[model samples]
Target chain A: MFTSIKRIVRSGFVGFWRNAFVSFSSIFVMTITLLVVGTVMLGNQLLGTTLEQIQNKVDINVYMVTTASQESVLRLKTSLEALPDVREVTYTSREDALAVFRDRHKNDELTIQALEELEENPLGASLAIRAKDTTHYESINAFLKEQQILEDPSAPVIDRVNFNDNKEAIDKLTAIIDTVERVTYIAMLVLVVASILITFNTIRLAIYTTREEISVMRLVGASNTFIRGPFMLQGVMYGLVSGVLTLLILYPVALWLGPATESFFLLNIFNYFVAEFGRLFAVIVGSGVVLGMISSMLAISRYLRV
Target chain B: MIYFDKVSKIYNGGQSTALEDITFQIAPNEFVSIVGHSGAGKTTLLKMLIAEDRPSGGDVFFESLNIHSIPKSRLPQYRRKIGTVFQDFKLLPHKTAYENIAFAMEANGRTDTEIAENVPQALELVDLADKIWNFPSELSGGEKQRVAIARAIVNQPDIIIADEPTGNLDPIATYEVVQILKKINDLGTTVIMTTHNKGVIDALERRVITMDEGRIIRDDAAGKYVL
Candidate 1:
């Protein structure tokens, strides 16, 4: 069996060289298909990173009653900060709120006069809460709603609801980005599937050209695997070439596109993570091996009845 | 020994049966010539011998083993014991006459030393030893036919099936191929051949099994193509 295996491998290689064009073309198809698959994976990562940047802008704000005690509001701010979902919280006292209002109305004398004419400070002390992730904002909202210290019975009504209130617009923006990411993922999946089908068809054609050889081999008493073994190796060679070449073809393109894309989409983000060349290359080579092996196996399986 | 036990074969999707109610037996070392007109189930008989086609009814037995009923996994081993030659030569176009012969030995699990020794001997038997390295395309029709014969005999099986072994040859080439088959048969290998070349068939005057319309029309000692 081992000796037969050697001959089959040798014969397959010899035949491949005899028909150089078809053999090389098989490799070419294998490479191109693997490239398309690997490229989709990288594209998915890019989309994921972009969506994360979009989600980072969301935050939860806690408003305090206008007459709430400064000590109670400070205590509430400290408690909110201790929650796992709360990344950070900034406490704004009533005096600081008034000062901000006065600063804004410095050039507007009528507004400043109206503000002075008011019997009390109208601005409320607020605690701005930053959640660990965008989705945690809702949980933080519920948690804040059950807290009693944020609302003062002696002051104007203050519910734990978000006060800055761009929640609807933020939610809509996140949804749009989420939809875009989903569409991109679905499109990438379709492309990978299409690549496999294309690879299968191409390998099928390669098998077709050698059908006569296969029949003659069978008649000459060659075992089914002995005849099929070489063709499977042919597929492996194609896949290996394709996979390596795809990496070669795409690596430079990725480098060229990465900075250009980063500049366009993530001007203030993406600096936190460094590029991982080895992991990316391993992925490309692995993709080529799998693609080549599977396509060849599929083609040879269809040729089995002979 | 080969026996056809009332075998009949009908293709999967066809109007009529290709072969019907055929029964015959050929003993070991017998050189039997099967003569029939085209579409007369001559090739069909050869197909059943190598287990290429199953009989739709009855059995095809080589000794005690029903040739048609061998398991799929056991087919390669069963075929290794038989040698087959085709009218078209079926030689790998890129292979030398020697490699073509060696390929057969390789298929039957012969060691390299055995193939190296026997391959030359088989080519010499076909009288093509000097042209052993020449590719099939470079050889004449006679030489290619000889290479096909050499490939068929290199493994030295119990039986050599020649389906129209000289179907593509001229009168001279046909005679040469017949001489080779006779020499192999004389060496005690069973020869089963099918042909329409009456001159060679009559010249050899071997045991003839005649068929018409998928049935054995005649079987005679030293028979001729009476059609």
Candidate 2:
């Protein structure tokens, strides 16, 4: 058993090296497939990061009337914070709002003179509410509406709710993210399946050329495993080499795209690739080996039947 | 010993008959030559012996075991008992002559030391020891066929089946191949050969089973080249 294994491995290496052109072509095709798969993975990561950044910037701002007390505003903030969907509610006091307005018009002397001539600060205290997920904003907005109704209807303490103004932008962003996620997943699935089939047929063609050699092996009394072992090893080698090649190829690609992606989406793909090198290596190389092996096995089985 | 008992092979549901009710026995260590024209069932009969093609109506026995009925898993072990050579010299084009012979030994689970020792000796026996490293494409027809023979006998099988081994060789190479086969037979290994060459048949003067349309027309001890 040990001897047979050794011979099979030796023969596999010999066959792989001797049939250099065939082996090289197989590896080349497999590397392309692996690159597609790896690129899809990186694209998904970039998309996810971009979407999360956009989501973090989306929130509902609640404005308080100038006459509303700090205690009442704190109570509203505490209630909004108690909601399960609300991640955080940041309170800005009327004094801080007026100070921010002053700082903004600090460059404009006309605006400063108008602000100083005013008897009181016009800026209202506000609370900015953020939800755990973009989708949870609707429920949080509903909760704030309930809070508004609880106030005095004739003379309301709440000045305004800005959720409606931001609603169109949030919904559009959410729809875009959902559509993109679905399309990317479907495209990735289709690409992966297509790559597998192409690799399979390539291996099949390689085996077809060796059909006569396979028959000769059988006639010489080689067992099915003995006959198949070398080809399996060849398949594995193809996968191993192609996987490493894909990874190496991705390094340069990630470097080129890193600055662009980082500037646009605030995610450096090259840094992600390096940080996730272990996982990327496992996925790409593992896929290459598995695809190569399965293709080889299926292709050679047709010729193995005596 | 081998026996073919009333074996008949019909292809494509009786569209053509390759073998019809053939019965024959080959005893141990006997050099037998099968002589016939093309499509005369000589190749089919040899295939039946190797269990490459199964008989439709009868059984072929290697000792007491039915060659055709041997389970698929055990078929390799069964085939290893007999060495097979072909007219095309079916050596892998990518493998060297030494590797070609070593492949057979490797298939039989021979030790590395044994293969390292026996492959050279087999090549030397075929008198192509100098061409051990040559690939099939690099070698001539006779040289490639000799490497095939070396592959056949390297593992020391009980029988060697050479199917038209000299069909492509020149008179000189054919003579050389026949001499080596004769020498292998002299070494007490049963050599069954199928040939259309009358020169080779007459020169052998061994047991000849002449077939016509899948039936043995003549079986003679020390036979001559008579159709």
List the DockQ of the predictions in order: 0.51, 0.61
Candidate 1 residue pairs in backbone clash: A31-A242
The top-ranked prediction according to TM-score is 1
Each candidate structure's TM-score, on Cα atoms with residue i matched to residue i, is 0.85, 0.82
The Cα local distance difference test for each model comes to: 0.79, 0.89
| Regions of candidate 2 where Cα sits further than 4 Å from its true position | A1-17, A65-79, A108-125, A147-159, A178-213, B1-7, B21-27, B30-35, B54-59, B68-73, B92-97, B127-144, B169-188, B197-211, B215-227
lDDT string for model 2 (A146-169, tens) is 888888876566888888878898
In model 2, the clashing pairs are none
Segments of candidate 1 deviating more than 4 angstroms: A74-125, A130-133, A142-152, A155-160, A163-166, A264-275, B12-14
DockQ of 1: 0.51
Error of 1 at A22 (Å): 2.8
- In candidate 2, what are the lDDT values of residues B1-227, reduced to their tens digit? 99989999999999999998898899999999999989999999988889888889999999999998899999999888899889999898878999888878878888989989999999999999899898899999999999999999987889999999999999999999999999999999999999999999898899999999888899999998778
Interface RMSD of each: 1.7, 1.2
**TM-score, candidate number 1:** 0.85
